[model samples]
Target chain A: MTEGEFKIIFTGPMGAGKTTAITALSDQECVSTDVVNTDLEQCDKALTTAALDYGHIDIPGASGVRLYGTPGQERFRFMWPILASNAAGVIVLLNGQHPDLDEHLSTFVDAFWEGGRMPMVIGVGRLSDDDFFTIDAITEALVERNINPPVLSVDVRRKDDVLLLVEALLCQIEVNELGLAEA
Target chain B: MKQQRLGFVGLGDDTASACLSMLKIMDGRSGISWSLSDPDAADVLMVANESTDETRRWEHTSKPRIVVYHHNEPKPSASHVLQHPFRVMQLLSVLEDVASLLAPTQSQTPLKTDLPPSSIQAGAEAADVGEFWDSLHELLYGDFPAAAHWYVAQSDEGELWLDARSRRFMADPLLLKRMMHHNIRPGVLRACNAPATEGAVACSLFAMSWMITPHLPAGLSSWISADSAFQLLRWPSFGSLAKSRSDLTLCALLTKKALTRDQVLSLSQAAEDDTDRFINACAMSGLMRYDKADLQTLPGVSAEAAGSRFGGLIKGLRSRLGLSA
Candidate 1:
């Protein structure tokens, strides 16, 4: 039997720290090529995850969890379906600096869930110390969208912090899987 | 909201046919009223002609209103229309220009504004008007890109697609011949010695420029035709292998700010290089510029954020080179 490996995908708008979040928690070696964006948006300063980033981390000896990060720019919207199909769950990273979190979430929903069943999601609220966002504030925003996806504050640069959130998300995924099996 | 009727004086039967179609479409819409008349019945006339005699005839007569649609071809007489009438307007390359001009009233809107209104102002501008000609060109096997090389469409999905492929056939008569030149399409070699159809040349050039334009010189940043942009990319001596696919260059240029003026000049002068020519065209067109104000207005990531991304890459490069941060 193939060892049970849970696949997770990371996505969000451009500049939302998806790559940083995955790298922080990934236990196995991760491969990444971060570069600047210079499209019409003039987003040259935004760190873009060029190719898909992958990390294989053991889920505390149960099995190894795999995480993949895809680019969030609209121009790359063509690749969303491929990423969505491979994912068992998702982590949406919000830049918090933006005032339109709800709009952003709606766009993501349109991109990933418009045609099929939505994936299990965990709303990772980035920029914790920033005045504009807090764990509670991010939670409320997710709940408003009927997402209620285990919203939590996450600094993508920290390994342990990202792990805590991932562990919580895995538990939610397990409960969801159990519910589905029973149904 | 005063509406006006449009006319064609000395316009060839082909352009007259296209203008007639545009008139029919406008007639169906509310608030804009229009009718197409032979030069005799028209209150406002749009004249397009190649013959100097035909052009001079329109010049002497002053209709209360007139717009000159000059059919610029490779023939030497193509530029002669410039001598006609200042009040004359060029062909409405896009329907939005036609609608806005023909709709009339209030402010004095100058006709034939060099760049199409879509790039500067945003409104129903709706389905690219060029789609009609593009499809027609496909049907007739006419070289559409060659005929309307200046038209660039800003895709609703926010990507750029080329309509005309003129840049492929027309060597940059304005530039020196020795520049390293090539078309800018991703993965395709620009310096192909084999002759290509004007359409293929246009398609390849546009595909390359659309990708390279985002990483163009600070002076150039807005959407521009691949041919024009290829001219700019030729300024930079250093050429990237990107072929302008998926805007990879934009990402790299914004993040790294890796290109130099000397490099830009070389690429700009590289007549063989399409990406270099394209980057230069955008910069020259004022569509692409380094204005912080314009940068702030872009829909995604802030200018400051974009700059910092470059700063980080520069810092990394500096450290590698043992230079001060």
Candidate 2:
């Protein structure tokens, strides 16, 4: 039997658009723990998420996806495992325009998959102009770590784009289930 | 196809031979072909080992030159410089660039390369074929030892089914090649829903392959044909398998329109193969999509509309936070 409930966590470094993505995809008005930004050096956004962003979406005849976004700042990283508890998959949102994108991706991938393996999908945002963090470079990074998750470009503000990430996660779950069943 | 005359200067016989082999691999794939010619008659000159006399001679010539240098050696200031022990794709890219510089008008043709015989024929010698299968099997299953079943969307005796083991499908080399090139995994098959009809299976296979391989088969090349329109699936990330800055430039240009290959090449100094490689890499990474329809004419979200939406969201946030905007 197919699973009915999926809890997926959205994570990445600062300015990755997690909050905006949750707000875009959430059926209910998203619940965000955002506060006035104090760390201007870290990010230039007016506000920053301090705790988590919460949302949910229901798909007919399949699992209802519960979306959670982790605070991008490292100070609140203690909440990562807590939010990721019982997560069916992970959606890592990265800022492609950031100079430190490759390092940020490596750090997050290490953190998320440290204890165990989980299916992941990487969504890169703000990839306008001559951005350096490409999908293949991200894929290469993941492949280097023996992780083969799907990497895509996404404008998190678009609901359809966010949905695509969720759908990809669900597909990953189904694939994992089949592998287990066959095994 | 028009043959592009190439002249070699100061290159060792081994390096020259290697270049010829690389050209052979790239032959019939692109509109341009390469043939050795006299220096004066050549459209492009390849220089190696820093032969001062030869460099001096070529300096007066109008032909575009590609300098070959050792990795540790200081690369010459040339329009193109290929490192020693270059990969086939890298060499092809340089050649394409030189071709574009030589004859801009002729470079617009959609590049196509002939597939190696080893990639297609399933009826090769048993021992040689077995070795190929073993290598491919090792690549796929060796990394994931726990993956017991691999589902392929190919038919065997009209039976469309999953093969739990690689050895069970040794007779089908094409399937094995696909598995290797596409890096096909159990996840792909499950996501695609295996055991479907033949057409569905082929479509799924193509979709999955496009998501992986850096190169597409000839059959799939039409999707990005020079006349057909294409759009980026998403914005390009610098992290792509793209080998040069021109590739990224092409990627950025592609995001705004459903451009043809000729249009894309004309916009940037990137050659057809480089652009093709960039497109294929983007497609494999799920960054682009191609269609026959011209999507540029379709209505899209305006910058003003997007800005307004963000502006409203910020205003609401400011109000909620009791902050003046």
- Model number with the top lDDT: 2
Model 2 reaches an interface RMSD of: 16.9
Give per-residue CA lDDT, model 1, range A74-124, as digits (tens).
677777777767565676666543434545666775576533234344444
TM-score of each: 0.32, 0.40
lDDT of each: 0.41, 0.56
For model 2, the stretches where C-alpha displacement exceeds 4 angstroms are A1-5, A58-64, A114-116, A128-133, A181-183, B1-325
lDDT score for residue A69 of model 2: 92
lDDT of 1 by residue, B1-325 (tens): 3455666667656455545543432342223456766666665556554456765676655454334434344323322222221210122222223443443431233212233332322332334323322222232233321222232323232212232322222222211111125322121111111231222211223223333443334342233322221211211111112222112223222212223333323322323344344444334322233322232222232222222212332233224323322
Q: Compute the DockQ of candidate 1.
A: 0.02
Docking model 1 quality class: incorrect
